[model samples]
Target: MKKYALNLIFVFMTTAAILLNAYSCFAKDIAFQSSVDKNRVSLGDDIILSLTFTGTQSIPAPDFTNVEGFHAKYIGPSTMVSIINGSMSASITHKYVLIPLKAGKFQVGPVTFKYGSDTYASNILTVEVVEGPVSDNRPIRTAGVPPLKFEDKIFVVMEPQRTQAYLNETIPLKIKLYVNKLPVRDIQLPQFAHDGFSTEALDRPRQYEEIRQGILYDVLEFDTVIFGTRPGISNLGPAELDCVLLEKQRRTGGIFGDDDPFDDFFGKYTAYPLHLKSNQVSMTILPLPEEGKPQNFSGAVGSFDFNLEADPKYVKAGDPVTVKMIVRGDGNLNTVTTPNIGSQDNFKVYDPQFKQEGNTKTFEQVVIPKIETVTEIPAVSFNFFDPAKKQYVTITKGPIPIKVEKSTEREGLKIVEADAISRPLVKKETLGRDIIYIKELPGNLRKKDAYLYKNKLFLLLQSILLLCFIIIVTLNKRRERLKTDIRYARRIRAPKEARNGLKESKKYLSQGKIQNFYDTIFGTLQKYLGDKFHLPSAGITANIIDEVLKNKNIDERVLDELRSIFNECDVARYAPTEVSVEKMQNTFLKLERIIDYLERQKL
Candidate 1:
């Protein structure tokens, strides 16, 4: 009886051991789901693929190396533990965001985790990367419109307030990205072109929480100012974008998907690319007006007010007069001519020095003060045509009060008493005046030889000095005439100057002297403008040349070439990029062509 009982016990024990081993190998407490809303994604577009792992106990963290196709960024790692009807369950999940760098199709295999010698993996996923629109093949219907696929249904666009503008004109470029009923997250954006423009990204994209084109979509929008290089037609391209979208898998009752007594509330989420495009825009760069354009027009296009003051109106003969010229107004103050103090005969007026304070962005100058001093200063007038009112405006300052004394003054200004002043005035009326006229006593003055030898030497020295002055004056007049004539001036000096500039630039490039190259090009062009058009270095711009050429009736093609040269120099001045020898050579050729073309054109 004992032997038989041992055999049955052995059989039962063995059977139990076999059943336990089988259950360990095949049975699983962990569950999972894998899904993505989009099958295709564009470069820079975001996609969300969630992995949910549920088990009787905590699941082990996943090793993501198996899915090597993705450039993954960790979104968040979370765990949930719940108890119901005396049953306990727990899950640990990790969410990741992935972006593709290029276009192609990729496969992401089953994500697996191991815990206590047990291993588990989710279903395999496949994603397609395309060049164009990024969206899942989901139907979207709104406001009696036919069902539309997500890619076909939504669009983002940019609308510029004005397509064409003068160089530096602040143009409002607005962008809006919209779709129907999609959860969205702003993604990384592409770097736009910096073609002679400064850009500022607004604080946040304006979000409109509404539906458009019958589909509920997040409308994301922003604005930027596109400044042109100069007054010429230029294109501000389409603002491209990337976006993240979440699709709720058609939930019936629960917070996420279909509600069921045992069904945990969860939604399958994915990311889609938002491609925003704007229509090709053309802006008419209204060339700056050259007719009646003031020679001193400091490129200022707006109206402004000017004021003048002197530190001390009354001063001794040799005392310095601090004449302050303050021009303040809402206009192009920087471009306005520094007011000239007409003639400096009595007062030795040094160059009218200046101090300017203005906001170039607003085209306003708060204060541009110029100071000069003299014992006596005549009143000077500044003339400006008020464009708004269509009238000539003039500002004049000072017969300016002055203190008069001997060449050397021992005392300051004295106030004469009323009683003393009245007595002198009464005596002047009672006194009779006698006429004392000295005629040019012709040759008799020479007849009375006083200090004959010294006087003769003085007269001869005076004659020689006078003769020299006449010769110097004649030469100065001729030089001024040559400088004043644009055609003659350029014909005389442009070739030599341009050649020197090109040669120096080449030298600088060979020696790796970038700054010197920039200076040479800029100075050469400035000197060219000064010589050819009589414009100052500080006043060179494409618009200025355009107007001048138009007035002179130069060929339009020649003007275009001039603009190209200016643009090239401007790029080298501001851009932090290296220029190649080929590029420099090309630029040199372009500049030479422009100089030659303009030189030949009759003006």
Candidate 2:
């Protein structure tokens, strides 16, 4: 037993020595270098610049005071510790998102840092800013130079190809978002209010850069088609869009070191939500003209080409021949109808099959020659109103000749179901089997009720329909209440928000971030109370919360707990010092319990 114990001790000491030797390589070289995610980026595009310290995670971030051609925003620091092949190494990387302001090739820092008696300098990083948008295949609409508005940072515009269009004529609509040097994300689809018109859904937007008044702006355009439905003056906008904007702002005081030189560079990103609305567009919708209107004219208001083709033109009598009618061009093909083969003496026509792809619509039908004398197919006319010509046009095609040979097949006999002579049919049975009277049933047969309400399947289907209607009504009412009832919506959102805030506070606490923890805690309590009482979060104060809850006969102990937390958060955030982990845990628990108690109250 003693020998085994000695062997175990010897193994443990050997392992410890190996681990220490491996980890001692962490600070051996103390090398610093800089790199970027992209060597080439488009103007107004974002690139990441990283300063990697290949020595230790304890090094302070170096200043990027000489970053050219791009505005630098310090996001955060990342640390990595790895043991590879019995060698332990650690590194700290500081990352910055660089938004290019101009088009040029620029060099980023040879950043220098001093530690102990040694100094380290990072290598320079070169980045090229291309003059246009990122590589995308979709072509952007750059014809209209939209005037900048609202500080020229961000705006949206809605423009139509023409202000006036004939009824049933299609107009190309463009909705564009111009972002000039502003960092934006989460762009929503624009809502275009097009009354007195029919519209197609907006397709995927094309992104590119356009120059306006000697300034470059990033453009995202949505192209869609719309047509006037009725003749009159119509208004078509107040186009609305929502997006989130990112702006660099000073940190609202965190627990991190205040004397750090990189604080300004490491400023926080604040999101400002924006709703952009474009002006309403008023335009005249001209009615279609009445002169020289074709008798069979349909509302097809664009240029089009028509063709007719027949296959198996030499079929025998009673054999089928397929004829295809194709109409292709820049028009609403939905309004183009199949041409009728008009009255033929010895031909039978069947319903045609229709297919549409891109700008073409094709109709195919099978016509059988009933007799061998059918010399040709009849002619049919297609009529449409051309908005460009402002007149009606009619195109006629057919009289397609074909060879129809008579079939040599034998004829079959036809069956006559009833005798042509109407002798008393009820009393004329000569066979052994007795026949029932024509006008009446046998006495043994029972009659069935023809009322539809007696059906079980019908009743079941109606019950299911009624249940579905009730469910839909309930959901619709709930949606409307959420939209219009502010207090109710807030009350519903209170618990989820409280949970999220507490979760964030707990994360900060674990990270040893004292000021952030207090700030999150304080904000959480404020938002919770504000939502619970249906007040603004910005106006919520400890005293106000106390008054509000006290009026509702809240427990004094709960109020005292709330007051203590609020005061602690105030003190810790403004005059932040060391706060114990145990204290933070206790504060978190108290906050959670108080929130639970308040939520349980009817008020």
Candidate 3:
């Protein structure tokens, strides 16, 4: 009886060991692995958390009750069956869409499932929720991918080459738009407010493709050059772009098929106004070194080559000679001044006429040699701060040799005049003489006029003559005042100038020169106001007109009409759009009425 009991115990132990080995082998074949589409996701962005089970198709749906910090939704199951070496294998992948409620790191799994009396637990997945959407090209599962959000598909970036720069140094700035599967239209060019810098836009935008975090995106790039005028921290942007998003219109079918005819008649396009702006970027601009600054530097900060040339090497005294000075290279050529040609005592140098084309600046200066002894033109020197070399460079050019001959005509005329004045007077012999006889008669003519002088008609004629003389003198004094007093001259000529400009504009209007017509009309009004108010014509803006006319007892209606005319002209000039003929004519007439009213005003 004892042997039989021991044998029974060993058989029971062997059965238990066999069962445990079978369960271990089954567990090894079946894997419950959890993975996420994206390890990092933005708040409000949906994440795909998939629990994949291989080696068996009998798995139950995963329990996501323990998942926290996210709204979880079951996205149905995807199954794949494969036959390898005549052995059938299957996988069941259960997907859940998880939208993070807040920005934090959260775990998605350890999802438990029971199959064949065995509990299988998937690996826990750690997901990081970021503040902004992830810019990546990761493939999104069909069931979990959400609709494209504006912040996700399209964005603007204002990127500067460097955030730190020296004062007056050129900073290359790039304003770029990244697009991913979004259609846009009616795009207005980007703009930014650069108050403290000298800014210049480059050529038109360029299109290209770039990859950001595994996502391919179309990029539109705009380039610009900026120079910080002052030293300190300067804010660059908040670059703004205006565009219209072209969204696909949904087709609506009536309760009865093919019944809605109105839907077909209407265009199948919908546009949403989208204004995109980039974040502001700050730059630290350091002031240029003052220790080695040249005294003659005129705020030039670029690489440049200086050249000086004279047109005619030989010329007569008192004749005009042109000195051409050219500055060529890549730099801020707009602010470059003419090189100091040294004291031009021997040559009368006028102001240099500056002309710029591309990277070259030419200064055409007219100089007249006064003295015949001057053998050479003065040496020209240009001083600039070379930012690349970090030093002050003085470029000295030649004392160009030239032959200056005395003007023979002037010298000869002077000698002749002097000789004529100093020569003694020659007495010519008097060959023929004429004799005249004088007679004394006529006493009867004087007595006849004595009675007429006392008549009333004669006194009346004399009074009329004196009145005419007084009128002539008053008119002469007024003309003199108009010439001497600038304010009075402008006020007097304003009306005539406006009238002339309007008449000229009519010809342009007749020839379909819309731009010229608007320009003429705008200039006429601006000049009329400028002269009447004694303000600078160049400084006359819409705001200035309003401010100046506000105090003048002008009618508000007239002011409004005037401002409207100015605004229209401004739009036409700057925007250059098609304008109607009737609109142009009406604007002309309104301007005339405004001028007439302004002329009648007391002030």
- List the pairs of residues colliding in candidate 1: 164-283, 179-217, 180-215, 180-216, 181-216, 181-217, 298-335
Instruction: Kindly list the per-residue Cα lDDT of model 2 for residues 134-181, writing each as its tens digit.
Output: 453223212233745665768888999999988888889999898775
lDDT of 3 by residue, 432-515 (tens): 544445668744654434364665554655565556556555765675455334467678878987899899999888888999
Which residue ranges in model 3 land beyond 4 Å of their true spot? 1-149, 252-267, 411-603
The top-ranked prediction according to TM-score is 2
lDDT of 1 by residue, 378-416 (tens): 665665554454444566776455454434536679888
Candidate with better TM-score, 2 vs 3: 2
TM-score of model 2 relative to the true fold? Answer: 0.45
Could you tell me the TM-score of candidate 3?
0.43
Enumerate residue pairs that collide in model 3.
137-215
CA RMSD, predictions in order: 39.9, 22.1, 40.0
User: In model 2, what is the error at residue 271, expressed in angstroms?
Assistant: 3.1
